[model samples]
Target: MSSPIRLYMSMSLDGYIAGPDDRPGQQLGRAGGRLFNWLDGRKSGGPSGQVYREAPATGTVISGWRTFKLAGRRQGDHHDGVPILVLTHYGDEGGDGDVPPGHARFVTDVEDCARQARAAAGDRPVMVQGAGAVRAVLRAGQIDEMEIHLIPVLLADGRRLFDHLGPDHIELDLVRRLEVRDVTHLRYRVRRPGEAA
Candidate 1:
């Protein structure tokens, strides 16, 4: 069986993933750093630490070009020893200095990217990060589940994760919910069409 594709993202209570002016230096954007405060770098013990400790089990990582770029190639290595696919619309149109060869593969098609990642991942789950990647995979109807780390702070203006998804309503089955210090984690299984809710 193919690996399940799961979208994992840290979002503010108001629904913003990154604050305004999210660039290379400002990875999460203005006050967006607060969204990730609950992450204890996989160290220590607790619900938050459990989340990070479990992340490395993911076989493949999918990220948007912007997210990959902002990581400066270093932070992106957090997945440590896993295949990382960077989704971009431009398709290798230069500006690859930050991306080390063999570290990541750039793909233009979301569906194809997800397929390749799933195949490379085998039975292990594939983790999807970045707003653009999440949006693309979601629009393509490729995401099997979503694990959102909802932060309490509200960034009124910034990049929203659910923007431009159209008017269609996608159903989701809540699988898990956990409240850790500074954040609330939610896991939902994306309900497919005709599937009994």
Candidate 2:
């Protein structure tokens, strides 16, 4: 096993990951896409811009179906070194456009997702992209790290930093913190089941 997995997400200061409308491909914003303006990606940068200015070299990217669809993906897109993985339950297959030319895999089982993510990750890190999906990974104790970009806005209600999970606790050690372009980056170790205190 290659050291579990990690979650990297952009969250509002109030902890809502996405606004309440919550439809595939429409979870964030209109033409401007202000939700992800902090992250150095297409919404924030032009086609030939710096998407990796603050991002680290991770090998795998995992996200929920909603996050995957809403966050427009370009085939062969690479940030630092991470490819993308979209999670789904076997029976919940909705229709989609042609598969992009990147390494996007649809895995039904969480364990299978973990295994595949680890394989894709190799020795590098995994950037867990959204809230509900990261919740699943954290609940299964499959995550190793979490990178959250703390934005300043606060939405009253929306998709949250965590979704419906059974009784659980997410206590992590603060690995690093930095404020860039007014956004705070928080890194944490997803404390394993029987790991050190």
Which structure among the candidates has the greatest TM-score?
1
Give the local distance difference test score of model 1.
0.84
Q: Give the per-residue lDDT of model 1 (tens digit) for 1-197.
A: 57999999899999999999889778888998888888764476777888877778899999888787788754446466688888887776414644445557778899899999999888989999888889899989999999999998889999999998867889999998888768888999999878998
Lowest-lDDT window of 10 residues in candidate 1?
A: 93-102
Model 1 TM-score (2 dp): 0.91
User: Model 1 off-target regions past 4 Å?
Assistant: 74-78, 92-100
CA lDDT of every candidate: 0.84, 0.66
**Candidate 2 per-residue lDDT over residues 68-132, each given as its tens digit:** 66666434355643666677663234236444446666666777778888888788767677676
**What is the TM-score of each predicted model, taking all chains together?**
0.91, 0.76
Worst 10 residues of 2 by lDDT: 46-55
Candidate 2: where is the Cα deviation over 4 Å? 1-4, 29-35, 40-56, 73-83, 91-102
> Over all chains combined, what TM-score does candidate 2 have?
0.76
